[model samples]
Target: MAQQVNPPRGMRDFLPAQKLKRERALAIIREVYAAHGFDEIETPVIEDYARLHAGLGGDNEKLSFSILKRGLRQEQLENAVVTGTGDVLCDLGLRFDLTVPLARYYASNRADLPATFRAVHIGPVWRAERPQKGRYRQFVQADIDIIGEPGLLAEAELITATSAALARLGLAGCVIRINDRRLLAALLDYCGFNAADSDRVLITIDKLDKIGVQGVIDELRGFGAEFVTPAVKLEHILNSYSEAACAGDIALTESGIAAVLPADLAPEVTSALISLGEMVAPGLPAGVRLAFDPTLVRGMGYYTGTIFEIAHPGSGSSVGGGGRYDGMIGRFLSQSVPAVGFSIGFERIIDLIDLPPAADQRAVALIADKAVDPAVLLRIKAELIASGARVQIATRTKNVRPLLDRFELDGFTEFANVRPEHTSMHDLDFKVFAES
Candidate 1:
């Protein structure tokens, strides 16, 4: 017997029904995106290692699937500086997410795209990491982005469009948790923290969703005594804020934030929070609630302004998230191109949805005895196909029973037994065939 082949770990083969379900779901998502004026574009799956290592993707960069340089000589492989080149093994790697490639695409084709491009990209992204339910080493990300827009309008459209997509997918009670990186920066300054501690602190606080307040405190203590004092202050402030927000007291959460912010930045922070609430409330479709969480701290290193996440019950993790990455594309062109984008975690959302019932499309299995005339079998097959039934033809013999079983598995609904000499026929509906 030949050995069975398997796909790589954390990857999967989509069976026919599964593929159809996913395609139907993607069509719904694309419709929602297209309604919001986003145009589709595609980029290559592989990118230069230099781009992947460009410090924009945060921890996702560490999980990049790098490939070895082609035709490397012995000296290049052995020597660290054979020709003033470092011992770099890989020159290219698979893209970790669509956002990176989008940025690169925009950089290369800036002259062709619109001044403010509303783009949609739905495709697979590879991440070399542990795979579990709703998480994969190879998965699809559906992203819609607005580039060259500086105002909060881009953020508003992103949030509203994503919420609409989820609602169209029949997911109710979804919450959008939002925050601003500038607000976080202001808070760090208010706490008398250094600029260098910003990202580390943001990464640490991002874990707050997994670990509770005290757990965060303990971990911050690990960063050294400098983090302990701010951690204590953060613990007090965030506890008070979360309680108030949970108790349905928005004003209290506001006051708590105002108390911690510096006098100069406090007013802007308060106003931005209010604007976020207002922008999300009016155009956003039903079944979506927006929350302003000061502790959001999304780990994407490139998010320079607003950040948000969309989550629902049973997905274990957020089904979608993205934010303002004003600086990411700028890295390529050495010029700023304001961009805000959101991505639906395509596979995660699929896990939560049930494929709606399919409409009736009757199928036929035309079975003939081996002793039957071959011309008769061919005529029956053509007739069944012409009569709007999906036809499957198999010879009747001792081995035919299992073939009929296989036919049923493939969704054939009716079975016909044809004879050459007797000029008689036997017919069975799919249910009777199943029982026999």
Candidate 2:
């Protein structure tokens, strides 16, 4: 018996058809982003271990895959074991997300880059997560970030470009759920949660979609008696909105945001969100909406201002998301530089969109009989190529149906049967493959 081999767990191998589909979708994303004035950039897959664990990636830091130091001393190994820490043994790690790498990239290349750099990055990131249906240890993220701009204009551009990409991909009914870390902080303050425990409380609140309102309250109550009152207050406010909070149907207007929260709590945050909505409203396509979701606490701790996630009716989870992380680049540059970014969840969106047929209708599969002269087949293929058609030569089989099906699966639109008598491209009759 032969031993079975496969790709590593939580990863995958794409077949020819699958790879073509993914690339076509990615090209559409790149085209849309470039038209929106975002320049594409790339970064190394691995970064210094210290930087990967710099307390910037939130929960994703724990899932980062670390690389062991090369040629480590036995003493170093023992020390790491005795200390029960991998930090001493690892010097680098695979990135868990693109935003952190983007921050580092901007900080390193600032002198050469535009003062207000608008970047588009599409690449793979690795995590050590337990694999699930929609989750993978390795996945791709498409991100557009604007650095060095401090105002709402950066946020507006990110939202506009991201939404346009989704619309171009034919993903309809996408709702951009907006919020702010400042608003979440104010809500926590109004609910009487201790400032120090805000992050932990927000982590639980982030689970409101997974666990119902009562479930979130229960988890917070378990934190301590001090959390009980705040948890209940939070629940009461959410309950007032009933299904609206869960559905994320709350309006984006100032009055709409105020109707659900404590008076005078982060009025500036509400105002900024309202203005953001109005700024992007005229730019977005029909069927795309922008709404306020006070419960939308994006899990990242680095978001200083606006945060949002893109939701689609077809997916149980957000198809994409990003936010303003003004403080992140400063951590690398030692100087404050305001930045905002939006990331399209590439893996998720690809599953939802069916890219239109390839524009080139000239892909041809030349099926040559085994008895056909090789020279004749090559001549015909060259002629088709010169005429602007993509041509592939395949030997004819007993049943050509299976061969034609394989060609169609590989993106060939038409097939031509070649024989000794077929001396020129015009001598062979070409037939289109039935739509799959």
Candidate 3:
């Protein structure tokens, strides 16, 4: 027997039914995004390694894939690699995400584009993270983002638009789960942690979903954070923040506050953070909850303000997430352009909605007498082709039911070929469009 072949574990092959379900989801998402003035754009599947690692900081370096090609071509693939230092070689890694390439696109094409650009894209992205259950080494992220919009309303629009899109997908119990990194920073300062240590603290806490609260505490303590403070003497500082976060006015003495946070940051910054928290709280839509999760630190270092993530209580992981980045673009352009964006994990969303896994099949078989006029046959073929049927000419002696059974087994719903009467082509054409 010939050797059998199968896809790598955590990857999949979608047949007719599954492909249809994915198409349905894509249709709704595109419709919603287009209605909001987002023009569709497609970027390459590979990107330079620098872009992906730029925002990742050090936490996500292990998740990137490097390109082996050297020089300029390798330079192009560098951003796609999860991790690798020095000059490029030959093998280019696949893209880890879309945002890095989009940023590069914006910087390179600034002259040809409008000041404010809104783009929507749906495509595959790869990651080196452990693949299990809903997670995969390769998956799709349907994304929407607006650049050069500086106002908080732009941030609000991303959440609002995403909410509208999800609603169109039939999610009644979904929650937007908005959390501002600025607020987390302020709370962190209040708890007495500097920027470097603060980032470490947040990364540990962000894993709260995967690891329970106690697990987070254990991780934080392992990172060398102080277990006690003057205001609250608890051994675990995270619990103190968890409790003090609800109190409107929790103050610390000079030694109390100075021992925890950096003194270089202005005191007024803390006040402004408190006010922003109040604004985002009442601004959240009904059925959605907003909170100041001191532990809600996103892994991306580029985010500067107002970060948000979407989650369904019944689902095991975040469906999508985004945040404001006011300074990242400044790295490439002479002027800084504020930007914010979100990406919907298409695979995860489709799974959450319980979409069927299958692919659509296209097969057309035509059986007609050999004596039929060539002109007539040509005309018949043209008409079916115009109607978008994949017509296949077959011998008149061949049995159609058996051919149809094979089509059915292969996942083809629409079958067409040479047959007597107009009903033959019309019926098959209708079926193809219906599946489409």
Candidate 4:
């Protein structure tokens, strides 16, 4: 017997019904993207390994799927072997995410592209991570980005357009949480911490969702930073988003690691909060809530301005997130170019859309015997094909009832017998055959 085959763990195969549902979801996303004036473009799945890792900050180096080159000369193989660390070899890697490749593409071909390049790219991205419910090693990302427009309006447009996309996908009651790293930076500065410590503080606070509020505070204390603000002050700052209005009472606090903030920092933080409030408050849609969170330190080190994430309550994780990465393109351009965009985790959208599992079924099966004449078989197939049924002519000599039973088991309501009457192909109505 031949060996049984199976897909690698954490990978999935979408059958006809499931594929149809995914197509419907993609149609909604593409329609929304086109309606917003983003032109679609495709890129290659493979890229230079050096360009992939040049600007990606943080600990993401571990996530790369390094590819081995097989067509290398003796010297090239030696160089590749030298680079191997422990049991792992490194040379080329699967593109981790689409954004990095886009940055490289724009830099290499900026001359032919428009000044304000609005693009919609939807494709697969690979990450080697522990899989859980709704998380996969390989998945798809649908991204929309606009460059050469630096105003906050671009950010607002991303929020509005993404909200529209979700609504169209029947995911109406989603929450888009908004925050500003600059505001957090200013708050840190007001607390008398330097830039280096601020990065650490923001990174630590970013994990508040995973680890509770106290865990973040304890981690900060473990870092041995000077006590800048009281515990009450910290809690108030974190909890202020839930309140109706900001008040001065949030300023009174003196406790562990909280006393380090200067007295004048409160008014400055409050003023910045007021400015952001005016920008995001008026445009928010119904069933969506936008709030300023000090703890929303997006893991990407590139984000310079406003950062936000949209999450559906009871969903396993955030549906999608993107923000100002004004410096990523600068890495390739050798001169600073400001850019900001967001990516929709396509696999997550498919999961959240509530699609039924794809079941195996044949809408129209040719149950005729192998002894059936070739000319007669061709006529029946042509007739069924014209009727829009997926016709399959198999010579397995299986009983008709068994085939129909399998079709019924797989949720197919409509089935057609494409076999001709009395072994004659003479002038049979395919319409009647399809109806039957």
Q: Evaluated with TM-score, which candidate comes out highest?
A: 2
Candidate 4, overall lDDT?
Answer: 0.66
Q: After superposition, how far is residue 346 of candidate 2 from its true place, in Å?
A: 0.6
- Displacement of residue 275 (Cα, Å) in model 2 is 0.6
**Per-residue lDDT tens digits of candidate 3, residues 315-411?**
6777788788777777778888888898776787886675332344244545555565556666766777686655555456555566555544444
Best by lDDT: 2
Q: What TM-score would each prediction reach against the true structure?
A: 0.82, 0.97, 0.71, 0.77
Full ranking by TM-score: 2, 1, 4, 3
lDDT of 2 by residue, 305-414 (tens): 99999989899999999999989999987789999999998889888998766777579998888899898888888899999998999998898888888888888888
| Candidate 1 residue lDDT tens string, 1-436 | 9886988889999875577668878998999999999999999999999999999888999998988799988877767465555428788999999999999999999999999999999999899989877678999999999999998889888888889999888887777877788988988777666789888887877887678677777887799878877877777766766544332234313554465344566567567766767767777778777776677777889998888887676667887899999999999997899999999888888878875533456677767767878776676667666767677778787767787777766656667776666342223323435455
> Which stretches of model 2 miss by more than 4 angstroms?
none
- lDDT agreement with native, every candidate: 0.79, 0.89, 0.64, 0.66
Cα RMSD of predicted structure 3: 7.9
- Using TM-score as the yardstick, the better of models 3 and 4 is 4
Tens-digit per-residue lDDT, 30-88, candidate 4:
99989978888888887777766675644455676767655657776676568854223
Query: What's the distance in Å from true for residue 132, model 3?
Result: 1.1
Could you tell me the lDDT of residue 56 within candidate 1? 80
